[model samples]
Target: MFVARSIAADHKDLIHDVSYDFHGRRMATCSSDQSIKVWDKGDNGEWNCTASWKTHSGSVWRVTWAHPEFGQVLASCSFDRTAIVWEEIVGESNDKQRGQSHWIKRTTLVDSRTSVTDVKFAPKHMGLMLTTCSADGVVRIYEAPDVMNLSQWSLQHEISSKLSCSCISWNPSSSRAHAPMIAVGSDDSNVTYGGKVQIYEYNEVTRKYAKAETLMTVTDAVHDIAFAPNLGRSFHVLAIATKDVRIFKLVPLRKDSSSSAPTKFEVQVLAQFDSHNSQVWRVSWNITSTILASSGDDGCVRLWKANYMDNWKCTGILKGDGSPVYGSSGQPGALSGVLGSAAAQSALNGATGR
Candidate 1:
């Protein structure tokens, strides 16, 4: 069974993005009101606001958390045409109150010519790396030279795309035998570009990122894309949010021993869902990548799962009225809600009463 539990997270304006930490115990939210707030889940299964501060001079578009091994770090991109890295200082005396953790600005990446649309921390195995995309159609990757130092970062690579890049996700699997890979999505609605989704692979010999593949079927503007966390699967699964929710499977080809040509791969559409009648804005996979949760303009969040036969199906849907509608198969449902509303209410009430 599924039930909606709303906790108030008062924010002054529209909340643009929310990101949970690797452990899923902490969350960070950014808003158009130029502020960011942090929440921690308590032992009682409730969430409380721990910190809130004015973060940027303009609307903050996205906030993402680095792996916990990096010490509670966060990255946010904004309409101010810059991205900021924040670090949480533990056991520090707050200016207004004693014995509170203080979040300090670590470094500001100011390279984008237009509004920064997205920011993401690279997988932990990649070691202290961050990537950002902007309305200028450029993607920049930055790295902390020293893992212990959060204040200094160096621009490692910059790639310019033909369309406005909206979001990116790093392939979490790190096999020393294979090159690093990342998936990028653009917000371009033009069909002439072939597709809004593209994959880039890092070439060790050339020391550059090269285009691996383009998903030609996704013609609509892509709001977000995520490469699922791989377990032991031989192939990779990618979830995309266009006008609808689309899933694709990427199978890598074995390198030919006799030939010197670079390795190749194939991408096939696995499923396309029309459950959300409007545009889907976000798609997130659980840690196991066994299920996917998507939210859209319909004011609802839908959960999709695959059966043993590899057939994908909608398992549950959470409506705006806080009701769960199960699929015909009678599988158990999952919880979903409007995270922004809770933040807005909390912001207005000036207390954690909700």
Candidate 2:
């Protein structure tokens, strides 16, 4: 059996989100430390810190990288009532030979009333849309600047929900011919009473986006959701982490059934493994879409893999020496820093001695 490799360390507080770049060459993580650090692969097969930035005044809750279409642009959300954008710049030959980078601050967006909870970019290239959810129970879309300028993002429209949104994910399977679509999950009260996973479709003729339908509701709150990564073909699955981690095979149709009520989409439960004792915080898929990783308030990271029968089984667990991920306790940042540093060192040292 192949062993699980330690990729990076934990945060000082709970790690709210983890995301990979389009090429899967880099990873970005955000935590309660109020900072976002970008990790890249080194020649020795080790992960090294490429860049770091303190983007949020309060704890950063979520982060996502822009699609290849956007050229390394990053978006992060925080409890500080704002979301900030970050970009990476490759230094010129002379500057690179001297081992230095010319980093720049492209833009920063602020929301006065609501604390931004999550942020996501459209999946395709040359895409100019961005979606953000806030504590004000509103989801807003903005048109990214044509160039690198971020002085102002034109607000497209805002969709209001009964409760604040906790998470959001854009469908990666839709092609250019079809209208864009996004899925969102809200708090438990909203999940049980209001529509849980609401799908929004962009209408070009109306120049507006309308709620097409609701997916499925759960008994507990929905915290995080992720679209499956495409190996060679487009991703046709979505995994949701909340009170439970659920995998759904998305069946995209050429013509969307026009219905106003919540229709339970034919979702196949690939696997449902209860590895975490507490509420799961985040879930991610590798480029292959075969393996899944989940983190929880229980302070453990569990790895799940699909078997021959297409059944998902818990294969590994990463424990944190007994720490609480939710409350004011637990040192998620320092521990993660040390562990990440150690992991990098180990990879550099190779399969030999430490």
Candidate 3:
């Protein structure tokens, strides 16, 4: 079971996204107000606003933290058609800070002509790589050849999905047996495309990313998508938010040495839930990939987990103010943070990650 907690996020406009740092000790939020706020957990377990500043000219759509190994770095995308990297400096002041902690803009990514919808940093194992998707259906990947030089980034590759993209997630598997993979979801209203989610894999032969698989069954407009941490599993698990909350497991099929084809997957729908009875906006997985939390138009956050038989079902529901909603899915349970540094799982802004 799970419980909810409320935060007084003081944004002038609609809050769009919240992301927790690697250690779960810090949280960052972005909004249509075009500003980002950083909160630090105190010794008493309460979160305090550490820094808040305007980072973009237009509405900020999403914000994500790079792995702690890369330093205190953040990437945010905006409707202004740019994605920017921000780095925290200890001595600088933002004027609103209680201390001298502040964040400085490192670089601005200006490749997208349309609103940049989502931005994500690659897995810690992938070096300092970043990916951003735009409303024009284009995905751009950038790499910082030198992690110390955050201002200099090389646009490594650009891929066009041909469908207006909404979100993108990198597969965080450290296993060398598989090539780097990324899943992209589209929010295009037209269902004629047949499939709204596409998985791409890096091709060493061509030194580029190639389409590996398409989740043809998901025909609706997808608002969010996430790849669960592999955790030594032979297959990959993905959670998606559309009209429903769905989970799929993709097991790789052995490849023939002579064939020049990419790896194929045996796709299976592990679970699907329309509990919200309306459009689901965002989905997120716990650090262990065992539990998933989703938010929808009903203004509630629901948690899903698998039983011993591997049957995924609702484990809890969090209503407004972090209270456990009285329902079949929720019992009078104890309060718990999904992750030690869990951000909003969110209802106000939108859930993205743990």
Candidates in order: C-alpha RMSD to true structure: 5.1, 8.4, 2.6
* lDDT tens readout by residue for model 3, 146-237: 99999999999999999999999999999988889999999899987778999998877778888889999999999889999888988999
Model 1: per-residue lDDT, tens digit, 14-110? 7878787776678788888899999887898788888889999999888999988989899999999999999998766546454345789999999
Model 1 spans > 4 angstroms off? 98-100, 256-263, 326-354
Choose the strongest candidate by lDDT.
3
TM-score of 3: 0.94
Residue 211 displacement in candidate 3 (angstroms): 0.4
Task: State the C-alpha lDDT per candidate.
Answer: 0.79, 0.63, 0.85
Better of 1 and 2 by TM-score: 1
Worst lDDT run of 10 residues, candidate 3, spans 339-348
Which runs in model 2 stand beyond 4 Å of their true positions? 1-14, 90-102, 148-152, 176-178, 188-194, 230-236, 250-271, 305-311, 315-354
Model 2 Cα lDDT, one tens digit per residue, 213-309: 5655454677777777654443257777776677776554444445433223445556665667677767766555666767666656655677898
TM-score to true structure, per model: 0.90, 0.75, 0.94
